[model samples]
Target: MADGTVKRQIAAKVRQAFAPLRLEVVDDSERHRGHSGYREGGESHFRLTVVSDVFSGKRRVERHRLVNSVLAEELAGPVHALNITALAPEEDSA
Candidate 1:
Protein backbone atom coordinates (compact mmCIF):
# COMPACT_ATOMS: atom_id res chain seq x y z
CA MET A 1 0.00 0.00 0.00
CA ALA A 2 1.06 3.57 -0.54
CA ASP A 3 1.49 6.14 2.25
CA GLY A 4 -1.88 7.88 1.90
CA THR A 5 -3.75 4.71 1.13
CA VAL A 6 -3.49 3.35 4.68
CA LYS A 7 -4.91 6.55 6.08
CA ARG A 8 -7.83 6.37 3.71
CA GLN A 9 -8.37 2.74 4.55
CA ILE A 10 -8.47 3.52 8.27
CA ALA A 11 -11.02 6.27 7.81
CA ALA A 12 -13.20 4.21 5.51
CA LYS A 13 -13.16 1.15 7.70
CA VAL A 14 -14.00 3.11 10.83
CA ARG A 15 -16.81 4.93 9.10
CA GLN A 16 -18.29 1.71 7.85
CA ALA A 17 -17.98 -0.05 11.16
CA PHE A 18 -19.22 2.69 13.50
CA ALA A 19 -20.95 5.35 11.41
CA PRO A 20 -19.45 7.82 13.86
CA LEU A 21 -21.08 11.19 14.34
CA ARG A 22 -17.58 12.67 14.41
CA LEU A 23 -14.35 11.10 13.26
CA GLU A 24 -10.83 12.36 12.79
CA VAL A 25 -7.99 10.20 11.61
CA VAL A 26 -4.65 11.97 11.83
CA ASP A 27 -1.43 10.67 10.39
CA ASP A 28 1.16 10.98 13.14
CA SER A 29 3.97 9.21 11.39
CA GLU A 30 6.03 12.34 10.94
CA ARG A 31 6.40 12.81 14.66
CA HIS A 32 7.97 9.41 14.92
CA ARG A 33 10.66 10.33 12.40
CA GLY A 34 13.68 8.52 13.80
CA HIS A 35 11.75 6.24 16.08
CA SER A 36 10.90 2.61 15.61
CA GLY A 37 8.34 1.63 12.97
CA TYR A 38 8.70 4.92 11.17
CA ARG A 39 8.33 4.33 7.49
CA GLU A 40 9.72 6.41 4.61
CA GLY A 41 6.34 7.52 3.18
CA GLY A 42 4.42 7.84 6.44
CA GLU A 43 1.02 6.32 7.37
CA SER A 44 2.75 4.12 9.91
CA HIS A 45 1.15 5.84 12.90
CA PHE A 46 -2.19 7.48 13.57
CA ARG A 47 -4.39 9.20 16.09
CA LEU A 48 -8.12 8.59 15.91
CA THR A 49 -10.83 10.57 17.60
CA VAL A 50 -14.27 9.12 17.10
CA VAL A 51 -17.62 9.97 18.59
CA SER A 52 -20.47 7.61 17.93
CA ASP A 53 -23.54 6.00 19.42
CA VAL A 54 -21.84 2.65 19.09
CA PHE A 55 -19.56 3.73 21.94
CA SER A 56 -22.37 4.88 24.24
CA GLY A 57 -21.96 2.16 26.82
CA LYS A 58 -18.53 0.86 25.99
CA ARG A 59 -15.41 1.16 28.12
CA ARG A 60 -12.11 2.54 26.87
CA VAL A 61 -10.57 -0.83 26.21
CA GLU A 62 -13.73 -2.05 24.59
CA ARG A 63 -13.87 0.93 22.31
CA HIS A 64 -10.24 0.49 21.33
CA ARG A 65 -10.78 -3.17 20.75
CA LEU A 66 -13.72 -2.48 18.47
CA VAL A 67 -11.65 -0.08 16.41
CA ASN A 68 -8.66 -2.41 16.44
CA SER A 69 -10.80 -5.22 15.17
CA VAL A 70 -12.23 -3.06 12.42
CA LEU A 71 -8.73 -2.17 11.24
CA ALA A 72 -7.14 -5.49 11.90
CA GLU A 73 -5.61 -5.73 8.46
CA GLU A 74 -3.95 -2.33 8.71
CA LEU A 75 -2.77 -2.96 12.25
CA ALA A 76 -1.14 -6.16 11.17
CA GLY A 77 0.34 -4.53 8.13
CA PRO A 78 1.42 -0.92 7.53
CA VAL A 79 0.08 0.74 10.68
CA HIS A 80 2.57 0.57 13.51
CA ALA A 81 0.91 2.52 16.30
CA LEU A 82 -2.58 3.89 16.85
CA ASN A 83 -3.55 6.43 19.46
CA ILE A 84 -7.30 6.32 19.86
CA THR A 85 -9.71 8.58 21.66
CA ALA A 86 -13.16 7.14 21.32
CA LEU A 87 -16.19 8.76 22.89
CA ALA A 88 -19.94 8.53 22.77
CA PRO A 89 -21.72 11.32 20.92
CA GLU A 90 -22.96 12.75 24.22
CA GLU A 91 -19.49 12.69 25.70
CA ASP A 92 -18.00 14.89 23.04
CA SER A 93 -18.66 18.59 23.47
CA ALA A 94 -16.64 19.45 20.39
Candidate 2:
Protein backbone atom coordinates (compact mmCIF):
# COMPACT_ATOMS: atom_id res chain seq x y z
CA MET A 1 0.00 0.00 0.00
CA ALA A 2 1.08 3.58 -0.51
CA ASP A 3 2.19 5.56 2.58
CA GLY A 4 -0.96 7.67 2.71
CA THR A 5 -3.14 4.60 2.35
CA VAL A 6 -1.19 2.81 5.06
CA LYS A 7 -1.56 5.74 7.41
CA ARG A 8 -5.31 5.93 6.87
CA GLN A 9 -5.59 2.20 7.32
CA ILE A 10 -3.71 2.41 10.60
CA ALA A 11 -5.91 5.23 11.84
CA ALA A 12 -9.09 3.44 10.82
CA LYS A 13 -7.95 0.19 12.39
CA VAL A 14 -7.12 1.89 15.66
CA ARG A 15 -10.42 3.72 15.77
CA GLN A 16 -12.33 0.54 15.04
CA ALA A 17 -10.38 -1.59 17.49
CA PHE A 18 -10.41 0.73 20.51
CA ALA A 19 -13.40 2.99 20.03
CA PRO A 20 -11.30 5.69 21.65
CA LEU A 21 -12.54 8.89 23.23
CA ARG A 22 -9.61 10.50 21.46
CA LEU A 23 -7.13 9.22 18.90
CA GLU A 24 -4.33 10.92 17.06
CA VAL A 25 -1.93 9.32 14.64
CA VAL A 26 1.12 11.34 13.71
CA ASP A 27 3.63 10.54 11.02
CA ASP A 28 7.05 10.84 12.65
CA SER A 29 9.24 9.35 9.98
CA GLU A 30 10.49 12.68 8.73
CA ARG A 31 12.35 13.23 11.98
CA HIS A 32 14.22 10.02 11.36
CA ARG A 33 15.17 10.79 7.79
CA GLY A 34 18.45 9.15 6.69
CA HIS A 35 18.53 7.01 9.80
CA SER A 36 18.49 3.24 9.62
CA GLY A 37 15.08 1.85 8.71
CA TYR A 38 14.02 5.29 7.58
CA ARG A 39 11.96 5.06 4.42
CA GLU A 40 12.76 7.81 1.96
CA GLY A 41 9.76 6.66 0.03
CA GLY A 42 7.35 8.00 2.68
CA GLU A 43 6.39 8.09 6.35
CA SER A 44 6.72 4.79 8.16
CA HIS A 45 7.24 5.70 11.82
CA PHE A 46 4.13 6.69 13.75
CA ARG A 47 2.99 8.01 17.07
CA LEU A 48 -0.44 6.97 18.23
CA THR A 49 -2.05 8.66 21.18
CA VAL A 50 -5.30 7.04 22.19
CA VAL A 51 -7.68 7.36 25.09
CA SER A 52 -10.30 4.67 25.55
CA ASP A 53 -12.52 3.09 28.16
CA VAL A 54 -11.07 -0.26 27.12
CA PHE A 55 -7.81 0.81 28.73
CA SER A 56 -9.39 1.47 32.10
CA GLY A 57 -7.77 -0.61 34.85
CA LYS A 58 -5.43 -2.19 32.37
CA ARG A 59 -1.70 -2.25 33.02
CA ARG A 60 0.67 -0.54 30.60
CA VAL A 61 1.89 -3.82 29.16
CA GLU A 62 -1.62 -5.09 28.70
CA ARG A 63 -2.67 -1.93 26.94
CA HIS A 64 0.27 -2.16 24.56
CA ARG A 65 -0.51 -5.79 23.97
CA LEU A 66 -4.10 -4.95 23.10
CA VAL A 67 -3.05 -2.28 20.63
CA ASN A 68 -0.42 -4.55 19.15
CA SER A 69 -2.94 -7.34 18.82
CA VAL A 70 -5.32 -5.07 16.96
CA LEU A 71 -2.55 -4.05 14.56
CA ALA A 72 -0.85 -7.39 14.33
CA GLU A 73 -1.07 -7.82 10.59
CA GLU A 74 0.07 -4.29 9.88
CA LEU A 75 2.83 -4.45 12.43
CA ALA A 76 4.06 -7.71 11.06
CA GLY A 77 4.03 -6.40 7.53
CA PRO A 78 3.84 -2.68 6.71
CA VAL A 79 4.35 -0.69 9.91
CA HIS A 80 7.96 -0.66 11.03
CA ALA A 81 7.56 1.20 14.32
CA LEU A 82 4.72 2.45 16.50
CA ASN A 83 5.12 4.81 19.43
CA ILE A 84 1.93 4.25 21.36
CA THR A 85 0.66 6.43 24.14
CA ALA A 86 -2.39 4.81 25.64
CA LEU A 87 -4.64 6.19 28.34
CA ALA A 88 -8.02 5.53 29.89
CA PRO A 89 -10.72 8.12 29.18
CA GLU A 90 -10.64 9.30 32.78
CA GLU A 91 -6.86 9.50 32.70
CA ASP A 92 -6.69 11.59 29.61
CA SER A 93 -5.49 15.16 30.06
CA ALA A 94 -6.97 16.28 26.77
Candidate 3:
Protein backbone atom coordinates (compact mmCIF):
# COMPACT_ATOMS: atom_id res chain seq x y z
CA MET A 1 0.00 0.00 0.00
CA ALA A 2 0.97 3.62 -0.39
CA ASP A 3 2.62 5.38 2.52
CA GLY A 4 -0.26 7.73 3.28
CA THR A 5 -2.71 4.87 3.00
CA VAL A 6 -0.67 2.82 5.43
CA LYS A 7 -0.44 5.75 7.84
CA ARG A 8 -4.19 6.27 7.70
CA GLN A 9 -4.77 2.59 8.30
CA ILE A 10 -2.50 2.69 11.33
CA ALA A 11 -4.36 5.72 12.66
CA ALA A 12 -7.71 4.08 12.13
CA LYS A 13 -6.55 0.91 13.83
CA VAL A 14 -5.27 2.85 16.85
CA ARG A 15 -8.47 4.88 17.07
CA GLN A 16 -10.51 1.72 16.96
CA ALA A 17 -8.37 -0.19 19.40
CA PHE A 18 -7.95 2.51 22.05
CA ALA A 19 -11.04 4.66 21.53
CA PRO A 20 -8.98 7.52 22.86
CA LEU A 21 -10.22 10.92 23.95
CA ARG A 22 -7.50 12.37 21.74
CA LEU A 23 -5.27 10.68 19.15
CA GLU A 24 -2.84 12.47 16.97
CA VAL A 25 -0.69 10.58 14.43
CA VAL A 26 1.78 12.76 12.64
CA ASP A 27 3.81 11.72 9.62
CA ASP A 28 7.23 13.20 10.30
CA SER A 29 9.12 11.91 7.30
CA GLU A 30 9.14 15.24 5.52
CA ARG A 31 11.36 16.81 8.12
CA HIS A 32 13.93 14.10 7.49
CA ARG A 33 14.15 14.66 3.76
CA GLY A 34 17.45 13.59 2.19
CA HIS A 35 18.41 11.91 5.42
CA SER A 36 19.06 8.19 5.72
CA GLY A 37 15.92 6.04 5.87
CA TYR A 38 13.78 8.91 4.62
CA ARG A 39 11.30 7.79 2.04
CA GLU A 40 10.14 10.00 -0.76
CA GLY A 41 6.49 9.11 -0.28
CA GLY A 42 6.43 9.63 3.51
CA GLU A 43 5.06 7.62 6.49
CA SER A 44 8.49 6.55 7.67
CA HIS A 45 8.56 8.31 11.04
CA PHE A 46 5.58 8.98 13.26
CA ARG A 47 4.66 10.60 16.54
CA LEU A 48 1.59 9.24 18.24
CA THR A 49 -0.01 11.15 21.09
CA VAL A 50 -2.88 9.18 22.48
CA VAL A 51 -4.98 9.95 25.54
CA SER A 52 -7.51 7.38 26.67
CA ASP A 53 -9.25 5.84 29.63
CA VAL A 54 -7.76 2.48 28.67
CA PHE A 55 -4.37 3.82 29.68
CA SER A 56 -5.58 4.96 33.10
CA GLY A 57 -4.03 2.18 35.17
CA LYS A 58 -1.33 1.10 32.76
CA ARG A 59 2.34 1.73 33.29
CA ARG A 60 4.35 3.60 30.67
CA VAL A 61 6.16 0.47 29.49
CA GLU A 62 2.88 -1.42 29.22
CA ARG A 63 1.26 1.37 27.29
CA HIS A 64 4.03 1.36 24.74
CA ARG A 65 3.92 -2.41 24.52
CA LEU A 66 0.19 -2.29 23.86
CA VAL A 67 0.69 0.14 21.03
CA ASN A 68 3.59 -1.87 19.70
CA SER A 69 1.45 -4.97 19.71
CA VAL A 70 -1.28 -3.19 17.80
CA LEU A 71 1.18 -2.26 15.09
CA ALA A 72 3.37 -5.27 15.21
CA GLU A 73 3.18 -6.12 11.55
CA GLU A 74 3.75 -2.57 10.44
CA LEU A 75 6.62 -2.12 12.84
CA ALA A 76 8.19 -5.24 11.41
CA GLY A 77 7.88 -3.80 7.94
CA PRO A 78 6.97 -0.30 6.79
CA VAL A 79 7.03 1.72 9.99
CA HIS A 80 10.57 2.86 10.65
CA ALA A 81 10.27 4.84 13.86
CA LEU A 82 7.49 5.46 16.33
CA ASN A 83 7.43 8.08 19.06
CA ILE A 84 4.58 7.28 21.38
CA THR A 85 3.20 9.58 24.03
CA ALA A 86 0.54 7.72 25.88
CA LEU A 87 -1.55 9.43 28.50
CA ALA A 88 -4.54 8.62 30.67
CA PRO A 89 -7.69 10.67 30.23
CA GLU A 90 -7.10 12.36 33.58
CA GLU A 91 -3.49 13.04 32.72
CA ASP A 92 -4.52 14.52 29.41
CA SER A 93 -6.31 17.42 31.06
CA ALA A 94 -3.31 18.32 33.15
Candidate 4:
Protein backbone atom coordinates (compact mmCIF):
# COMPACT_ATOMS: atom_id res chain seq x y z
CA MET A 1 0.00 0.00 0.00
CA ALA A 2 1.03 3.59 -0.58
CA ASP A 3 1.59 5.97 2.35
CA GLY A 4 -1.68 7.88 2.14
CA THR A 5 -3.80 4.90 1.21
CA VAL A 6 -2.84 2.94 4.30
CA LYS A 7 -3.88 5.77 6.59
CA ARG A 8 -7.19 6.20 4.80
CA GLN A 9 -7.88 2.47 4.93
CA ILE A 10 -7.17 2.37 8.65
CA ALA A 11 -9.45 5.31 9.37
CA ALA A 12 -12.25 3.90 7.27
CA LYS A 13 -12.03 0.46 8.88
CA VAL A 14 -12.02 1.92 12.38
CA ARG A 15 -14.92 4.20 11.62
CA GLN A 16 -16.95 1.34 10.23
CA ALA A 17 -16.24 -0.91 13.19
CA PHE A 18 -16.55 1.56 16.07
CA ALA A 19 -18.64 4.40 14.73
CA PRO A 20 -16.54 6.60 16.97
CA LEU A 21 -17.78 10.01 18.06
CA ARG A 22 -14.22 11.21 17.56
CA LEU A 23 -11.36 9.57 15.69
CA GLU A 24 -7.89 10.54 14.65
CA VAL A 25 -5.44 8.49 12.63
CA VAL A 26 -1.96 9.96 12.40
CA ASP A 27 0.82 8.55 10.26
CA ASP A 28 3.98 8.41 12.35
CA SER A 29 6.17 6.55 9.89
CA GLU A 30 8.23 9.64 9.13
CA ARG A 31 9.42 9.74 12.71
CA HIS A 32 10.55 6.12 12.47
CA ARG A 33 12.85 6.63 9.54
CA GLY A 34 16.00 4.43 9.67
CA HIS A 35 14.40 2.28 12.33
CA SER A 36 13.58 -1.37 11.86
CA GLY A 37 10.34 -1.99 9.93
CA TYR A 38 10.52 1.50 8.44
CA ARG A 39 9.69 1.50 4.78
CA GLU A 40 10.62 3.83 1.93
CA GLY A 41 7.13 5.26 1.93
CA GLY A 42 5.40 6.35 5.11
CA GLU A 43 2.51 4.26 6.56
CA SER A 44 4.38 1.77 8.72
CA HIS A 45 3.57 3.46 12.01
CA PHE A 46 0.44 5.14 13.29
CA ARG A 47 -1.25 6.71 16.28
CA LEU A 48 -4.97 6.30 16.70
CA THR A 49 -7.33 7.96 19.14
CA VAL A 50 -10.94 6.84 19.10
CA VAL A 51 -13.83 7.76 21.34
CA SER A 52 -17.09 5.81 21.29
CA ASP A 53 -19.81 4.15 23.32
CA VAL A 54 -18.50 0.71 22.34
CA PHE A 55 -15.55 1.24 24.65
CA SER A 56 -17.62 2.38 27.62
CA GLY A 57 -17.42 -0.81 29.64
CA LYS A 58 -14.44 -2.49 28.05
CA ARG A 59 -11.02 -2.87 29.59
CA ARG A 60 -8.08 -1.16 27.96
CA VAL A 61 -6.76 -4.44 26.56
CA GLU A 62 -10.18 -5.33 25.24
CA ARG A 63 -10.54 -2.02 23.52
CA HIS A 64 -7.16 -2.42 21.88
CA ARG A 65 -8.02 -5.95 20.83
CA LEU A 66 -11.17 -4.68 19.16
CA VAL A 67 -9.21 -2.16 17.17
CA ASN A 68 -6.51 -4.65 16.37
CA SER A 69 -9.02 -7.21 15.19
CA VAL A 70 -10.59 -4.67 12.88
CA LEU A 71 -7.23 -3.83 11.37
CA ALA A 72 -5.76 -7.32 11.40
CA GLU A 73 -4.98 -7.36 7.72
CA GLU A 74 -3.17 -4.02 7.78
CA LEU A 75 -1.24 -4.93 10.87
CA ALA A 76 -0.15 -8.17 9.32
CA GLY A 77 1.12 -6.41 6.24
CA PRO A 78 2.02 -2.72 5.78
CA VAL A 79 1.51 -1.40 9.30
CA HIS A 80 4.42 -2.04 11.64
CA ALA A 81 3.16 -0.31 14.75
CA LEU A 82 -0.15 0.96 16.07
CA ASN A 83 -0.44 3.12 19.17
CA ILE A 84 -4.05 3.32 20.17
CA THR A 85 -5.82 5.54 22.67
CA ALA A 86 -9.30 4.15 22.92
CA LEU A 87 -11.80 5.96 25.09
CA ALA A 88 -15.46 6.31 25.91
CA PRO A 89 -17.05 9.69 25.26
CA GLU A 90 -17.04 10.44 28.99
CA GLU A 91 -13.40 9.47 29.30
CA ASP A 92 -12.53 11.69 26.40
CA SER A 93 -14.22 14.65 28.08
CA ALA A 94 -12.36 13.99 31.30
lDDT string for model 1 (1-94, tens) is 4448888989999999999999999999989999999998899999999999999999999999999999999999999999999999889999
RMSD of each: 1.1, 1.4, 1.8, 1.3
* TM per candidate: 0.95, 0.91, 0.89, 0.95
lDDT tens digits, residues 1-94, model 3?
3338878977888998999889888898888888877777888888899998889899999999999999898888877888999999889864
Candidate order by TM-score, highest to lowest? 1, 4, 2, 3
Q: TM-score winner between 3 and 4, please give it.
A: 4
Most lDDT-accurate candidate: 4
Candidate 4 residue 88 C-alpha distance from true site, Å: 0.5
lDDT of each: 0.93, 0.85, 0.86, 0.93
What would the per-residue lDDT of candidate 2 be over residues 1-94, giving only the tens digit for each residue?
A: 3348778888899899899899998888788788766777655788899999999999999999999999888788767889999999889988
| True-vs-predicted CA distance for residue 86, candidate 4, Å | 0.4
Clashing pairs in 3: none
Stretches > 4 Å off in candidate 3: 1-3
Off by over 4 Å in 1: 1-3
Which scores greater on TM-score, model 2 or model 3? 2
State the RMSD for candidate 3: 1.8
Candidate 4 has an lDDT of 0.93
What is the lDDT, from 0 to 100, of the residue 75 in candidate 1? 93
Worst lDDT run of 10 residues, candidate 2, spans 35-44
Ranking by lDDT: 4, 1, 3, 2
Q: What are the per-residue Cα lDDT tens digits for candidate 4 across 1-94?
A: 5539999999999999999999999999989999999998789999999999999999999999999999999999999999999999989963
